[model samples]
Target chain A: MNETALKELLYKIADDQLILGHRNSEWTGFGPLLEEDIAFSSMAQDKVGQSHALYQMLQTLGEKDPDTVAFMRNADQFHNCILVELPNGEYDFSLIRHFLYDTAEAIRFEMLSESSYQPLADISKKIRAELRYHTLHANTWVKQLGSATEESISRLQRSLDSAMPYALGMFEESPFEKDLISSKIFGGEQALKERWIKKIEAVISQTQLRLPDWKALQPVTGGRTGKHSEYLQPLLDEMSEVFKIDPTAEW
Target chain B: MPTREQVYTWLEEVKDPEIPVLSLVDLGVITDVQIINNEVLIEMTPTFVGCPALDFMKQEIHETLNRHGIDRVTIDVTFRKAWNSDLITEKGKAALKKFGLAPPPSRELFTELDVLEHATCPRCNGTNTELRNTFGPTLCRSIHYCNTCREAFEQFKPL
Candidate 1:
């Protein structure tokens, strides 16, 4: 197994969870409804915790400690897809992003459950089970609001269309795609994207919203290689502010 | 030299911080206990990977064993035996119901939403319950509303 490839894989997955988890936390007080507020907050806790577990796995492979790896990294050092790092625009936009992003993650972890790396497989199984509720929550809302009324439907439709390009960016191939696939560490991004498309389409078909033509949407790539949008650096700075102020601070 | 059974007995003093009535042993997060050359090694798994109660539970385990006068204690939290609701004991299930939270149904036949969507209300033992939210106040719970009691309750979600 290529150690570098494995670390790259772990970093991207962990970074995605951490960044999205932070974005989810931003919804704690701002959800359209109280239930949605609690839902996003709970999911935020779950995502951040899951990322910490992944970072621990990385530490065993000779990476830095979870706290340093999470809090000390700059935007260019992260490997999360742009979809997760983007600002949570509105309730509709956030809902659409949640629906799209978690759909892929649910499938990604499911595939990783069978990973040849025994430890990854073990944690993946646990994470996969927890993600079921996330996808369920996302699908329920997408279906309801996607079909509800003129304003609700249009709001979601517009967000879905705007988010589609970045959502497709989620499958931006890793430089080690071949090694990860050949070594069976991951089933590969293409396969994950295919499964993701089917799952999201199944949910979207039940609603009034339209999924843009897959072939026509150009993916907003480069995040996997540490090239991120202007949005990421600010998020990183804000997230690490307290930690940077006092690196040795304890709760 | 303490027996493995004795160590488990001492562990019974450690309860889940969230659910005071339940012991870690009955909750089934305590996966294995071994006595190795006067040292005690315990392996445990979390109910949910993100469960906030995990660190507190780990601390409680160490404190409880230390109080038992076993100075050499090693507690390893792993996903090796990944916990599922099925790992919980019948005693634990009863304790949860008694604590006013519905116990998760067996996951053996848990493929559909129906199992998760409907829970037997702990208050009235009524099956007429609607799932209010899948994500609850805690990672391990789900919110449900029972028509019989006309009150909302939480369930120890089946994972």
Candidate 2:
């Protein structure tokens, strides 16, 4: 297997979880309902925890420790998709993004569970089980809000339209797409994207939300290659502020 | 040198931090115990990868062994065997019920919401319950409300 390809794959997936987990934590005190608050916070914990596990795997493959890899990096070094780094925006937008992003993630992990990389396969089996709850939560809300009222339907529809491009960016092909697929480290981005589209469409069809034409939408690419938006650096700065204050501080 | 059985017996003193009634041995996180040349090696897995109680549990295991005069303790936490709710021993389930949390049901597959949405009420032992939230105060629990008991309770979620 190509070590570079494997590390690239691991870095992007781990970065996505870490950034989105931080976004989910932002909802802790601000969720529209008590359950939503706990839901996002719980999911945040799971995501961050899952990312740490992935980073540990990377360490075994010769990367830095989880904390250093997560906190010490600049924005340009990150490999998360732009969709996760975007601000939570509003309840409707956050819900929409959650619906979209987790839909893909659930399927991604399911595929990775069968990965030829034994360690990844082992962890993915555990992660895939936990992600079932996340997708369930997201799906329930999306179905409800998508058909609830004119205002809710409109809000979710607008967010869905606006988020489509970035959501598509989630499948931005890594330079090692060929290597990852050939080595069976991953099933490949395009394959995952196809499965993702079908899954999201099935869920959205149950509600009033309309997915944008797949071919018509332009993907906001480059995040996979460490090309992120202006939003990423600030988010990273805030996330790592405490860690930077005392690098050796023990909790 | 302490035998593996003796080490396991000593570890029975260490309880899960969150659920005091249950010991780590009964909780089934302790996957293996090995002793070689006066050194003790213990392998364990977490109920949840992000479970906050994991480190505390590890510390408790070390302290418990240390107290037993087995000072050379090495603990390895891994996903090699990967823990599921089914791993909880029968004794552990009773402990969880006694502790006022519904024990997770034995499950073959967990792809649906049905298993989570329904749980027997620990207070009333009634099946008439409604899921309030799939997530609870902790990662391993889900909140449910029982019509019979008319109380909100947490279930050690089936994963």
Candidate 3:
């Protein structure tokens, strides 16, 4: 197994979870309903914890400690796709993004559960069960809001259309895609993307929401290679705000 | 030498940091305790992967044993095996009820649609209940309202 390929895979996975987890947590006090608030908060905690675990694995592979790596890094050093770094716009947009992003994430973890890397496979197996509930939550809400009222249907449709491009960016392949695939560390982003399309389509088909043409939506790429939206730097600053105050202080 | 039973009893005194009424042992978070070379090694698991209480719980566990004259201790937090509400002891269930939180059902069936739908009201033990929301203030809880007692309560949701 190629060490560089393995590290690249871990960095992107860990970064995606951390950034999106922060976004989900922002909905804590502001959810349209208290239930949604709690649900997003739960997912936020899970993602953050998952990222911490991955970061710990990275530390064993000769990287900086999880705290320093997570808190001290500039936005360009992050490998998360742009889809996760986007602001949570309206309830419709957030829900649509959650549905799109988590659908792919669930499949990605599911594929990695069988990876040849024992540590990655072990963690993925544990994470896969948790992701099951996330996808379930997304699918249920999408079906409910998608078909309910004309206003809700329209709102969700608009968000879905807007999010489609960035969601495609989530599958922007890592430069080591072939090495990851051949090394049996991952199945590569293209395979995961193909499955994500089918899974998202399955859920969307149950509702009034329409799936847009994939060929038409130009993918918002560059997050993998470290070019991020303006939104990311602000998010990183906010997340590390307290940590930067006193890195040595034990909280 | 401290016996395994003695360790278990000591752990029973360590209440869950979130829910003070229930001990960590009663909550089923403490899976095994072993005595090796007079050092206590604890094997424990979190109720949820992202459970924020996990670190505090570990600290409490260490302090509880340490204050009891066991200085050398090691705690291993493992996620290879998941936790379910069925792990909650009978005492823990009663404690939750007395604390105004409905205990989760012990069954393994956890379909997302019906996970929180059937919780009996903790206050009045009412059978007629409606699920207000599947999410609550904490990861282990959900909100439900009782038609019989006309009250809303939290249920320790089945995992």
Candidate 4:
């Protein structure tokens, strides 16, 4: 088996969860409604905790501990897709991003549940169950707001349009994608992207929102190789603020 | 030497930090207890992956067992197996109901939309209830309103 390919896949997944989880948590006090706040926070906790689990698995496979790996890494060291690192622009944008990103995550975890690696398969099985609720939340809201008011519909449509390129970036294939696929470690980025498009379209069809022709759009890639937006470095710096305070001290 | 049964009994005094009415054992957080050599090892599973009250629960367990003369305790939080709502004991359900939060439905009956559609009201014992919101103030609950009593309450979500 190609160990480097598997590690690359794991790093990207873990980084995506961690970054998006931090973004979700930022809505704790800022959500438009109380229930929305709680919902985002709930998902935030789940994603971050899930990221920790993946990092722990990485540690077992010979890496630094989860905290160090998560908190101490520079933006260029991260392997997350660019979609997760963008600023949560507004409730509309954030919601749209959440819907887009989590749909991909749910499908990704589902595919991973059947992986040849027992540990990855086991963790994926457990995580896939949690992602069900996340997708349910995202789908329900997107469907509701997408069809609710002209204003709501228009706002969501705008957000959707702005997020599409980044959403496509989520499917950026690694150099070792073929190795991972042939080794049965993962179903590969192309397969996951196809599934994600179908799932998201199914939800969008129920709403007034439009699913753009993916082929016409240029995907905002580079995240899988550690190149990131200007926003990622500041976010990483903030995330590690406390941990970096005393790297040697246990809190 | 405290027998395994005695340790279980001692654990009964350890309440879930978030839900004070229910003990950790009844909440299904405590999975296994073993006495090996001079140490007592207890396995646990969290209701949610990032359950904020875990540290407090662990501390409570340590204090509860230590008070009972078992100081050599090791708490292992395991995620190898997923936790299900079915693990909640019968007594735990009753406690949740009495504490003004509806207990979760059986795991077998938790179809996709069933959680929002059906929740017997804790206050009026009424089947006529509406889910106010799927998200609640806490991690494992959802807000609901009883049509009969016109009272809003929380229901522990079926995991």
**RMSD in Å for model 1:** 1.0
Error of model 3, residue A53, in angstroms: 2.3
Q: Write the per-residue lDDT of candidate 1 for residues A67-173, one digit (tens) a residue.
A: 99999999999999999999999999999999999999999999999999999999999999889889888988899989999999999999999999999999999
Please, what is the whole-model Cα lDDT of each candidate in the order they appear?
Answer: 0.92, 0.92, 0.89, 0.89
Off by over 4 Å in 1: none
lDDT of 4 by residue, A44-118 (tens): 988998898889888988989999999888999999988999999999999999999999998899999889987
TM-score of 2: 0.98
List per-candidate RMSD values in Å: 1.0, 1.0, 2.2, 2.0
Query: TM-scores across all candidates?
Result: 0.98, 0.98, 0.92, 0.94
Which model is ahead, 3 or 4, in terms of TM-score? 4
Candidate 2 chain A lDDT trough over 10 residues, lowest sum: A208-217
lDDT by residue for model 2 (A1-251), tens: 89999999999999999999999999999999999999999999999999999999999999999999999999989999999999999999999999899999999999999999999998899999999899999999999989999999999999999999999999999889999999999999999999999999999999998888999999999999889998999999999999999998998
Model 3 / residue A21 / CA error / Å: 1.6
DockQ values per model? 0.83, 0.86, 0.48, 0.50
- Scored by lDDT, model 2 comes in at 0.92
Model 4 lDDT per residue over B54-84, tens place: 8889999999898888889999877656577
Write the residue-wise lDDT of candidate 3 on B1-159 in tens digits.
699999999999999887999999999988888999978999998887678898899888889888889888899886555566788999999999999999988656776666557678998887689987766787677789999888889988776
User: Which candidate gets the maximum DockQ versus the true structure?
Assistant: 2
